[model samples]
Target: MPDHPVPDPGRSLEGPLAPVTEEITAFDLPVTGTLPAELHGRYLRNGPNPLGLDDPVQHWFVGPGMVHGVRLRDGRAEWYRNRWVRSRQVAEALGERWAGGPVHAGMDFAANTHVIAHGGRTLATVEAGALPYELTDELETVGPCDFGGTLPGGYAAHTKLDRQTGDLHAVAYFWGWDHLQHVVVGPDGRVSSTTDVPVADGPMVHDFALTERYVVLLDLPVTFSMAAATAGSSLPYGWNPAHPARVGLLPREGTAREVRWSEVDPCWVFHTLNAYDDGDRVVVDLCRYGGSYDLSALSGQGPLTLDRWTVDPAAGRVGRQCLDDRPQELPRTDDRVVSRPHRYGYSVVTGEAGPATVRVDGSFADDAFTDALLKQDLATGRVEVHRFGRDAVVGEAVFAPSAPDAAEDDGYVLAFVHDPDRGATDLVVLAAQDFPGGPVARVHLPARVPLGFHGSWVPDR
Candidate 1:
């Protein structure tokens, strides 16, 4: 089967998308419109930021992780800060020894893909590697966390929280391991349980899904390849037709040995919007790609379409359908509605073009370079798009509830928009109820925040 070509690592580091060289902070950012008085939190985003300009990492995902954050309080944009996660590799690159602690043998640490706040601690995480690194509310590195040395192994970049139980769930896959571990971290920040699920090949499980009764895992065709590693490619995983494509549904309180695996057509899903228990079946909404990903190519594939998969555990079957044909990714719904039927979902509308040139990745490059924001009403089958026109690009729009008890969809959408024309970036806030009415406010940044993977809104307590 034909696969997409590899992306040029050097070219990925050029232009406005290039990683920042150093960390900096700015105070009292300018705003164009009135800030939301109810919005009191920090908008923090994480991405790969190499330690040196000449560092040669073949894939964009492997660079050192850095975080950019903007603090908001009482309708004021107080300050902005960017800092490296200070992983062992990053510390070594900076002529400093790893001061965090002794990492587990065979664990690689980057912690660059995502940043989240849980159990009164902020963490920077990367999948399939070392333990999560703790960060202060100010985004300073507190050190690596092993949940007081109780965490069994590496943590995943995408971990889901149970609103009712305050428990965190994750499925973790190591680089060469044939088995994946289902880990549960309790509300008090300790590993509650872990179950090892065996598989034929080590597939890259970027993200998983959570329902009220089940934990959904994707075992796709992308598998670890010895040939790719021997060839010195930075990303050693590639498409393998021999690998079976399936989804596993494990009961929330059950072990992996009790998992029911259902077969689905060969495809790849990097992110899951939401999943819910539909009586006897489980319904999952995600951004799905038809086949395997080409780690070498800049864009990867043509486009990822929003898809819905209905998994019937009793029949061991997965029924799939495309919800929308437009190229989009980074699907997010209101956190309060997670693991339940949700009415609204939002994603960045990615296009074929990059900031100033065509992206080498066969698909659109990053959410940060997307042309618009899309809001989908699952009940009405209606799609509303907020286009930024030609030169402006937007990142993931995280939904911020107006209050602790705000109604679903009664909130604001926050994202960072980079305008190439101005050579600057802005924190854009949109009223969720009013779809395409333009930004309610724009907080200007002194420098451009490069396109990145994931971010979150940490409300001030």
Candidate 2:
């Protein structure tokens, strides 16, 4: 299952993955330092914009889910919106209308990637099976949310929020499903629990690892590609070295015959920087992609380190450990230590990579961006970098917790930076124990927040 070739769909969407065409909203924006009057609310990001910025895009995660908010309160940086998750083909490609709800397996498209906020709503997720699009805390588009209907299936884009029983844990998958479900949404948003599990080459479970007893499941080696979805490929998943690189665990109330698989060694995890339950062993930590899409181009794959995985279900074994070999990816920790034990982790800094860069107008761009912003320290391995140089492009950094029992590196880290010499975009922040210092605030965003994928500092609870 390794040589399926066929990936070249053309790539370039102009500049930092360009795609902004309107939908502005601005307000009291401009700020530079000091903004933490207990740092109030909305940082909400979610990407894959693409409402046809000159067409040609078979996969940059299949565009069409934009959402870039920024609100704050006491110490104000107040408003700065940018919606477009209308879905139903972005509301029929903007002629308007659809924004309506309930479209489970029939998948109403665009929910971009991540923009969480459990029970009290505010979601916009996306993954193999799509079905979450409820925004509206100023981001509009309140539509597809199967939870009230109890969500029987389809929904995922990384949803693990169990700050101790507020449950939310997702793991859905569906290239037509040969199994892999594990939902759990309770906390009043519904879908109490689910379990499926099966498997055998439908893999692409993008992200998973939530430990307060286990839900880990990352079957690895990419998988799912009906020949790149019959070659139209809007992200048809790839790299299937015969699909057998396991790690299942399951049992946070168990089922699927109680899960527990364990085999590891073929890597590919999109994100996860936290997981815990030591004792009977569970550990996790992530962002290790020794391979991906194989040229089915997600920046054409590989180069991302910082691993760790213990799993040891008594003796079933799964021990990986490579804590930091540089090259990084979008990890983040401290959503109140999601799924438990965490000692700080945050990433962004995909430097030293190569692949998707053929722009002499022949298109194909995505030279990784992200010039620095890490903060590891997973119990004393200490890493704190914060470079933002090479003209700045950084993306996912979210941490924001100076209270509600603060003390885990105690405070802010936010991030949206993209200051290619002030062409725009700021929102910086960073002061979690002042690691690489400078920038206790920055806000200044009137536009250009392009480079994305995963965000939340939602607060205002």
Candidate 3:
């Protein structure tokens, strides 16, 4: 993870992205190997543990298609709440014998089988529903917005709650144009009324953000060409930071039309994968500039220039906090990572990087966190880097509550680490305070996870 000048940015790729040589870094993150081995054959206690994870599914993290309830006590680990019997017979009985349990053939892009489990007990979940917007006004107020329209798919959301109180907050990204939509839910489930946020219109939308009391929206540039879909990415594109970013709002009892907007172009990348508030001010791990290095563009060169930023919403300031020398990977995978597919040692020398051979110049940040794991201290410009050795990489990561009060370094760090050596992926956990000290445990998964989007930490509620 040293320094290298980004691929010389020049020319156009309006037609096709040129194929080039790859040069990515590999990772050897904290490891715990196989699930059963690490579980010490204790696959008995199933379900997520608030204190951390346990057998069957070690570590308290869930990816798409999974949602849970959590409970956190100051200085203690989290625990899954409301869970019951982990019975396969129960699940099958629920569907076949009874009528409540749902059965689906498989999974994909559709929001078909969203599961909400409380301590292994079935709760409210959606397999085929739009974003969860309880119309009772129990959550944040919602209405059509004028900024990015419903056409761009409006926004994508992930929700979390305050354990003691059922106070809920959802952070999402506007798909029409990159904007942050923050929604808060009270005890009665009443949500804050909201209005459309304004920003430079673009081709696609990414993720949104939320702190305790704020909603941050980011507006960036994206491109559209059928070609992008074929490669699993959209590049040769650019970004647009409209002078000032805005967040629209309305109180619970008020009309959605009465929403008030706040201007806050977060500090860095308009589309951040994940972040939380730093006190009153909103802190975002930002991503800047993005384009393409079609070998066709440079005749024979490859893609490289990818940078990251840290934005302070209160002051509307942007900081170029870290520069992941690998520009190729940033625009696609950001700072939030768990793991990637494993690639054997010898295959690497043969120019075969397994699945990641998708591109050349190794994995670098084009417009996101790149392949490097970066965490920034906004108050002091301090940055920490967890290099994923070689083609080995973690996808998105979720934080374990360090304390009931939410101490910055009090919780644990849980992620899915991609082990190319074994051609598989594993769920890994690490004490946040003991970060680089290594893993507390690793649970080998029964299957391989392709590059994933967002994830959550559902501790004991």
Best model per TM-score: 1
Off by over 4 Å in 1: 1-12, 95-97, 255-257, 298-303, 352-368
Taking all chains together, the TM-score of candidate 3 against the true structure is 0.47
Backbone clash pairs for candidate 2 read none
TM-score of each: 0.92, 0.33, 0.47
Error of 2 at 444 (Å): 19
Writing each residue's lDDT as its tens digit, candidate 3 over 1-461 gives 31111222221111011111111122233334322111110010112111111112211122112122222233222222222111223223223221122222221111211222222222222211134211111111121121222212222333434434455444444333343444454444445433444434433333444433444454433323335436543132322333344443323233342434454432223234334444534444433323321221111122232333344544545544444333222222221221111110000011122112222221222222223454444345444555556656565454555434544555555555566677555566555555555566665543233333344443333
lDDT of 1 by residue, 185-212 (tens): 8899888888888887789899999999
Residue 144, candidate 2: how far off, in angstroms? 32
Winner of 2 and 3 under lDDT = 2
lDDT of every model, 2 decimals:
0.80, 0.79, 0.32
Candidates in descending lDDT order: 1, 2, 3
Total backbone collisions for each predicted model: 10, 0, 85
Q: What's the CA error at residue 26 for candidate 1, in Å? A: 1.2
Error of 1 at 343 (Å): 1.2
Model 1: lDDT of residue 181: 88
Span of 10 residues, lowest total lDDT, candidate 3: 341-350
Number of the top-ranking candidate, with lDDT as the measure: 1
